[model samples]
Target: MASVKSKAGANNESSPYRESARAGAGSPSLVAGAASLSLNSSRAYALEDFDTIATVGTGTFGRVFLVRDKKSRGFFALKAMKIPDVIRLKQEQHVHNEKEVLTEVNHPFLIKLFWTHHDERFLYMLMDYVPGGELFSYLRSRGRFSNGTGLFYTSEIVCAIEYLHARNIVYRDLKPENILLDHDGHIRLTDFGFAKKLSDRTWTLCGTPEYLAPEVIQSKGHGRAVDWWALGVLIFEMLAGYPPFFDDNPFGIYQKILAGKLEFPRHLDFYVKDLIKKFLVIDRARRLGNMKNGADDVKRHRWFKTVDWDAVPMRRLKPPIVPKVSHEGDTSNFDVYPEDEWKKEPPVPPKDLEIFKNF
Candidate 1:
């Protein structure tokens, strides 16, 4: 097995786990170093078969890197996770769950996990590399999206989430940070660490507070319906540059969420306003616009009636703006990883055979 060592010496200022704020309770970096197991697959694996171009992002468990495959010469996002950290935090199940959910899902708007591998120290996931940056940063830079652009992205996310719900998967986390932009600027849903397959229902108080549905905060049993509530909040944020419910105090935000009040800009179009009203309804049973209606309801909304669904998915629509990469090899420009932290490798785990027994 290949040995690993932290590039950052003892006094390095760059903490790879700085993105912990975005991950909340499910940070990937925290779990990266916990598992110390190796797989017994007959197939041989080689790390040097790929070139690490740049660090795209980092989380509690590990960091994601842009790498070029030596064989296929294709670009891919390599997500590394520390095994011991994951087992220590009791998140081994969550990691398995994420892999299972991602394997079962196949949609253009959903990020695709191509392959997975693990060494004694780290588990690596190879995924489609979305060239565009995160949708959240895009929106922040643009102030707010135009109605046409917002509806286009929202409609795609609705389709993706509806597909997950239909498969009995509940995506508890829905936030701008989790939404990645494809090469064409279309929204692609990523990160299923907090997601679970719902056989019945759950009362876990997990998810971004700002995007949480009222039921989620109250610790009430919430199924896929919570996703609907979040969709409404997401759309409002996209249009207004902020979530419908917001307060500096966490308790105040919870109160606003339970109240389910929506305030729209006066100049917003009627169609957009109406869609928000239907989605923001306090009643989850009725919030998604007619219980019988599925994602089609949102797709058929008047605001999106003019959107070319086929074209949007095909990357036909011109993106509002393109990201500025410093150079052809500078994929790191779009990512937030600190360069000073990339000099050393992280520690590798000791080999253990039992780890593969459950997987």
Candidate 2:
């Protein structure tokens, strides 16, 4: 890794990406540095500008569509969240938070939100069309990653988590499914529904059961430290092809996490073995990032010795596995979905949409 600097001079590539004038104005302190910051214009986009092709992915409150921008002939992933479902599921706050965070952040490793819109019944978020599919999918196909592959992706994730933490945001969800690979095979951390800008602490019983940190399971307030813990779990899963802690039930998973019982398989590299041990520490204060030097402590470790932090921000390092994307509008990398599940409705504003004015 490049020798750490305190951002005392020009924009540090090792730090967060530089923010544009618009982003800097909104969150001055969080705008550390970036080579090029594509701030969200928040311009109005008509439905006609985009041709929604197919459903690429879905969740409890929304579906992601492969959309082609008619004007630029570019492709994008449009996330459509039904307001009624959000309200019924009591995920309105999460929806708002996701939209707000996505708009503010612009990093190579973080998913960028192009613009957001609403048509009464649904809220729409148009973002980068990452067609390489989920990291989870890649891991599943390969079973596990080589040590070098794990180090490469893990280094990028470290930069991402550090950037979010510097911005006073805590990404509660960090797992393979939420981590998408771009066309170049670099990691793009997505799904900000569980993310929040909490500089201090927050008590939210959220995130995947297997990935939840011990502090979160305890209902004890947690902040950015939880993210580091999740990073540990993610690194372990990527190399081992499974999470360190698991059970048939959520309760059992929580118990394993609280117990902090980690059994390493044989033939693991020394750097990974030591780093995971430090990161999985149950004591939040003693955790990797929570310790004195913070994220730098983790970055400076021997495991990441080969990581070129500056190159990561500029995407100078070529990824190990670039997706075979044939064209700009390629959907071959994504899974196919049934057509019956998609719905088409008018853009008329519902009478009950007053709560979304702020968004």
Candidate 3:
């Protein structure tokens, strides 16, 4: 396997996915030194036109940079992945799966994939930049959210998962990191790397251990219902600031998760508690948001009575907390890391690898 390096410098290659931009025609040219950036034929503008002001976060696959569009003067999170490294790690199939799922999904609650393109070495994904950062970090900073705040966030996530399930796609990964905040502070589900289209059922041991459902850990023929189970865990974390089934040892947590045991805080609201119980049910057939109840059961929960279903996406409701960054290009408060440290040539994969073919 080849080691991966950050693609944080300019490169020459025409993007295979370039197309006209949906935002409009006459988008500005991408800026120089914008790090492996390229224009997709399907997109009206090149990704490099935007100035990358700061690094929001990083993961094993790639680093997400906070960039501003020179044309729209808008903010966006650019997720850059090394194609050669992905194929070398044998994750090309996973990448393909994510792209397929992303292409088919279009919903308010889900993270928007504006466009995707690839060059000789890297894959670039231009995505909706949610400024508020990870929902997990927000929760950690605040310790725990109020009942109202928790319900509001939970409701949005439930809708996103419901929509994916309806499309026959199962979001195997559901954690705070995967959940991002839109400009209005609403939850947008991101990172479809672990997602899979379930024609019937699948048994893959994937996803974070804490958020994994019992059926997933058991490697049973799990379906879309696993998302519902994770929703329960998500709600628990939101309300109590931690998952109901957690331990220092992952094995212990898995055992508790399999047992379907839960310990709610005394201060949790009755409705919230009840909803968690229904979602965390051991029997997938009996879980909430199943074919019977669908997403309406979650929307109709007593805790969500004040929620305006139509207005949630519009962000008409007051956000629990607004982020410090007020504008798209505002990086005044953030101390951006030096680009040189992250700029290095990625390793090339062997010719035998099929994953590097399309990328």
Candidate 4:
């Protein structure tokens, strides 16, 4: 969103649903090496090559569809970005950034962008179809998660952030909606729209309000540390049933984040409390991952003492909940979507196709 660099305003309203921070249990998975190569498909897929099964999600820029490959009959999620819509939205650079980041980085915990193709009307992205749906839906259903479940998911997320930071990429957005569950229950962090590769800092005040870091709300230069802050919020919400700081308005939420006030549940463990305190530090320099030791310091914390780091990337840990998808074509996990086409565009000029030629 263009407001990434703008001040917090009424436009940044929180989703009434987003504030529903209760969560459920999940297990961890191992990570893979750096994504240094692009994907090579058997053959390039097209919009007409697949049958649209259903619309899985709608975002500011485009719509995500559950599609079946007619030739192989394999199910995949196709994220479609209409050219004229993106240009009108003024998110050209963000779209390009997402495509570039997806191509360069491949990890077990991160979503795989198989390949991209653009027609005159839209830019098409074929990605792995995560059948378990959003962690948000599961969280809302369970209200809260067990400590083991919370830690399991957090461990994988920690690995994801570690990988991104090592590559100098700051994932500005961290929320349950962006966290998809594989059929086996591992996290597949999706949507790289707000992701930016930065060695120093960028003053973009973008991110879900409840997850936004203090420095971001203050318009001070922020970096990978913002992601750590969001992680703290995520872990807390998973265990406590809600974020540590929340208010009806975005400005109010920002104010609470700046104040750094935290009211933990009395039943919470001291070690978990200590970890949250470490990451929620108002000063980005003092934040756990931002310190000299970086992510290791956070990983080595007492709360994660039982985690087997080596087994993490290998998908060895048994997840508590395996989604009940009987087949690859199951749409039972996703919310029923509206059937609006939003006015499709006819064939465009070559110049229009040039804009997304490399997508």
Residue pairs with backbone overlap in model 4: 29-312, 30-312, 30-313, 30-314, 31-313, 35-106
User: What does candidate 2's lDDT look like per residue over 167-225, in tens digits?
Assistant: 98998777777777777888888777778988579886777777888988898888999
Off by over 4 Å in 1: 1-46, 308-319, 322-333, 339-359
lDDT of 2 at 89: 56
Q: Which lDDT tens digits does candidate 1 get at residues 1-359?
A: 00011211111111212222111121223222222222222233355657777666665546677777778777766666666555555556666666678767877778776666655455666567776667777777888888877876776787678778889899866777677766556667776766789998887666766778777777778888878878888888888888888887767888998887777887678988888888777777787643777676767778887777767555566666566644333453254655444323344434431453333
TM-score of 3: 0.81
**Angstrom error at residue 106, model 3:** 2.2
lDDT of 3 by residue, 128-226 (tens): 766655676678878999998887787677767877887999987777766766556766777776688989998666677788778877778788888
Best by TM-score: 4
Q: Alpha carbon lDDT of residue 348, candidate 3?
A: 46
Q: Which segments of candidate 2 are over 4 A away from where they belong?
A: 1-39, 341-351
Q: Rank candidates by lDDT, best first.
A: 4, 2, 3, 1
TM-score of 2: 0.86
After superposing candidate 3, which stretches have Cα over 4 Å from the reference?
1-48, 331-338, 346-359
CA lDDT of every candidate: 0.63, 0.69, 0.64, 0.72
Instruction: Give the Cα error of residue 197 in candidate 4, in Å.
Output: 1.5
Ranking, TM-score, top scorer first:
4, 2, 3, 1
Clashes of 3: 13
By summed lDDT, which 10 consecutive residues of candidate 4 come out lowest?
Answer: 20-29
